[model samples]
Target: MTDTASLGLEDRTARVIAGQRVWDELTPLLASRSCTLLAAIAYVGSHGGELIKLERGSSVIVDASVSAVRAGSTDPSVLAEWIGAGVGVYSLEGLHAKMILAESAGGSRPAFLIIGSANLSGSSAARLTESVILTDSRDCLDEARSELLAWKIRAGKPLTLEEVRALGEHYGADRSPGRKRSEQDDTHDAATPSEELPGSTPEASSASRQRPTQLLLVRLGEEFDPPSEVIYHRDRLSSELGCDDADSDSVLFVFRDQSEPEWRLPLSQGAYVIGVDASASGRVTKQTEVAPPGPVVYLYDDDDGGRYCYLHLTESSRDVTWADVTAAFESLGEKPEFDRNYFRKSAVDALLSLWPEY
Candidate 1:
């Protein structure tokens, strides 16, 4: 007689795993299971394709909200495949929980349940920094199953094959060539310089030769003095700002001062500092009183005729203050007081005490 204890069923309860550990454990478990049900507030179709290919699952429920579409999280192609494969498909308006329930073949293996911050997408499962709690506890599994059932009964709307097909066609058309740019795409384009400028010749119109006449330093609500160091490059600026065009007039350029250790801006936060041309004219339309939680500084370089080295805060925090910005500059080895006299000097020594040597 085989000892069930040796099968490691008891050891599977209540553990947190992240990254590739999610894919490594989830794939084999799905393959061995007879019935798998997935409920996620968000779902991507490619992930659905992969899941259906692994095992014939009973059902999948996802949220079909405009926000998900704007974020490019849901794919209709995968949803169509789900319906074609005889898997039941459902959508709920406000579904936000992510859970998976799987029952083993013929009661031969322990049932499994997963709950976590991960979505049912390949990027979330394999690439993103995601964590989930997995367990085989009968009590937990039963409770999860019951709640999911209640949600389905009260909110789930069964998607018919025709509806899935129609949605797939709509998305396909939207993705087809010659489609109009989306508002999000346009916002991204505003920050990028993809095409040649309107009236200048290629030689004189180069982005490297354009110097912003004014630099604007702004936080949530108040504006500050521009930082002395600025570095501009299309790729770096685009990536840092989470936009496409690095040379848009409508958007502000933000970054951290180079004096601090290299840190990428967190996406969830709303705080930022903007860099504008001294020649540009605009009022501070956006407002936020809270400062970013940590120290942030700005840098700029105008030697190449391009605005570079703009720094801004990305995280949202109510505790950040002007003192934090001054302190970050002080940490770079010198604490020069800023005053009206300091602004009068244009020489390198006057602009930045810790400027990098080229």
Candidate 2:
């Protein structure tokens, strides 16, 4: 056993962390801007980036081998974000170790090394039985640094944006959501041969396969033109749409007018789709006061059925009407009806194309 007192650990240094205790030890180190991080882990599941807050100069190496991507063990989407943020993301075939290295920003303190079974994944952090050894001892740090350096060299060049995008496509295709009756029975007329629908573009197709966006329909008390901003009651959303605050991420909401004909998408107006957080009373509302740069979408209801849809694009986007949208869907053997609020990017793009440009 290592001497914890000498290391100022109070029974800490060279400590073994298991389960959520790993985060209890790790988050403080990451929160310090005075240190930089490098992680060599075999698998990074979807949205795994949320776990490790990587600084600009930080680095990560994962087992992004063909089999890993196909198995959904490595998520290219998170990798793509890391690359875009100028983080050095690399791939090493046959990499199975889970390790992290943290060095003082100015190289003032001895580097710390964390090694063991925990992966940089939600499952590992939240549910899996994981263990790791954390130590700032000089000898262990030196040996681990050397090992990570050797692997980094073997990793060669960091993945380029294009390479990561290609990997994302492959990953998405392999792990495509399994077809279900709920998704198909409402929108799709029938399963026709796989082919691009009329007016479909590669960009549209790619965007559609990405994370699905939810459309929240808020009914207005009176019919009128699009307002500068609209307010929504969080409690009402929970009661009507079963949309809790936690489900508000990536959600785009539109106001429905209390007019005749029941236009699900009444008009195209600018709306903010910011992240939602609960208020003091355990409810979220437009007045909750959140930051900006969140998703902004133009709201519209197809009016074909009592369904609302949201376009992923912003105000300075394309415009179309229900007629244009239905024509495109029908061309591909799909019905114009959008029974549910969750829309794939393809559906959003289709709606964006028909929505009137702001």
Candidate 3:
């Protein structure tokens, strides 16, 4: 027998399912048939364990943020089960949308789509007050599938087995009292009376070793004589360059050099811009933009050298780091020596000239 529809009593095409009823309705649907499941949840917990019971074809995509897998929120055991079941597990950075699409063979119910404020967690599905739209509309399911496929395409890379294992280890370690205390001490650098003596702490001795460094947004010039570099202090630009604030976690480095032969500049020096997130945190987070299937862009020397390629920042540009850019190029099987030299005056001019084009 078909399950009794619970919430969203008002809408004809969609129903609002709330609280524990959300799981009540979902669990039966998942178990009744062999289906394909696609989920994008911002946060997950042991309650997500329900997914493990799904048939072999099911897939799940989760946000890779640390907070998503925080000790109390996500159950590592559940994740491990999903991985061991040969389920397709992926991580999409900056993913906050919570959705589930289930497609089944010919039956009374062939497709189902759930989208709502609740994440895949016990509190979210059963305890906390939450709302989700339950729909069987073909249009809604089709659109969701298309959007999800697009997100998967832009993810560039999936969370590997090693990454998942590391999450489990970290979750386990963070729960230990000793590990928590060590972490607290490392961040605070202060000791209690019962702890180490006043002047004997390791942090006290290492205070002199901290070095001052600044984040810079650089632009390489047309001549490529001096690689462009911007230097600033405390997230503020000290230079006369009229470029926007460089304090953001990610900064764009525009390369406007004359195109060179693929052989001369194995990395293919051309007019393209790349963004680097200098902030130490969230370096692996992918951008929302639909990035091209391959590297950011490829450059080939135009015979005249006058043909310039201008890159305007788009919603789809990936949030990467200097390290990521270097690594991506390296993966191309070409090791091009990157110019690390910082030139102040030339860097300013290059930005100024390119600012108008952007």
Candidate 4:
């Protein structure tokens, strides 16, 4: 007799997945055989596609509007990769729902319906407090799939691989250098804490949540040592900054001349947007090794400019100068005595408005 295993179709239950468990459950569903995936998520980060295993019969709908791309929310290049892998990638403007349906098309496995507040990004799993209602109910899965399909149909024409790639290229070429803010605004000063900090309330509103790319402002002293390689202390990252689960696409902006009582411009002409690969609070050494190791953060540049590049600085501070760099910091309430600190997305947008030639 052929060995038999139950697909667990009779179990029609749902459970809430919060914290890191959200990704723990999702990986298996994405890798399940004969399970067709249908996702309608709003934001697709630069590495979002890489997280998916790319099922043959998968179909994904995302917000691929020009505004979303320019805002660095949806990456068209990621969608292009999915399309290249034979995944049906569709673009729906202003799509905000995050739902994934994995149903066995020609097998005995039970269907899965995942509805949650998380986006299709690594940050959602790592940084955000996301909860998904996972159910093995085939009926619920079918209904959710139908609704997603309707949205897909309403999205109009599907994007071709070339078209998506071109869009990504266009976005890269057409991105603005930076925006300017009035020097009078100092609401984002690192010295003055924002009203809605992390864990300030019993529950966090949608507005209180941190952005995908949180900015780290490093004040480089005249005598401060600059490491040839990018590194961050684990304690400084976790205990001090509460960025224990910082996204890999996070940024680091350096500034100079903090020692001066009065300075013309503070923002360094050279800034490295460090993409944190790995962060260890304590010494992490090989099991077989006896030598002590120091805390470190593995850094790399991802090549989407300073914004997404992982390890290296996409722009050299030696190349460009921002005429209003000091003004930009002042607008964000950056104090003269400020040292290395973290800035939110709103403040980052205000300070780092200019890009390549800033």
For 1-358, candidate 1 gives per-residue lDDT tens digits of 1212323345455666676546666555566543455454345534545643423466767754332332334566666666677666677643557787775544455567878766656555555567778777889889988877776775546677777655553342212134343322211111112222212344322222222111124323223454344324434444433435444322234432222221312211111223212212333222212232211122232454332333322332123334443444455555433211121223213223221210
Question: How much RMSD separates candidate 2 from the native structure?
Answer: 19.7
Off by over 4 Å in 2: 1-8, 33-35, 106-110, 172-358
Candidate 4, which segments miss by more than 4 Å at Cα? 1-12, 33-35, 170-358
Query: What TM-score would every model get versus the actual structure?
Result: 0.46, 0.46, 0.46, 0.46
Candidate 3 C-alpha error for residue 105, in Å: 2.1
The worst-scoring run of ten residues by lDDT in candidate 2 lies at 185-194
lDDT values for all models: 0.43, 0.51, 0.44, 0.48
In candidate 3, what are the lDDT values of residues 1-358, reduced to their tens digit?
3322332333366777776546766666566543378777655665666632555677777754443343234545566677677676677644667888877555644677889876666555545566788887789999999887776675556566677777764442222234442233111111111122112454422211211111123223234322222112211221211124354222223333343422122121111223233223322223312211111112222445522222223222333334444444355554323322112333323322222222
lDDT of candidate 2 at residue 59, scale 0 to 100: 89
Candidate 2 local distance difference test against the native: 0.51
Off by over 4 Å in 3: 1-11, 70-72, 172-358
Mind giving the per-residue lDDT tens digits that candidate 2 earns over 141-210? 7888888888888889999888877776545332335643222211111111122111144432333223
Best by TM-score: 4
Model 3, TM vs. native: 0.46
How many residue pairs in model 1 have overlapping backbones?
27
- In candidate 2 the C-alpha lDDT for residue 252 amounts to 33
The alpha-carbon lDDT assigned to residue 106 of candidate 3 equals: 57
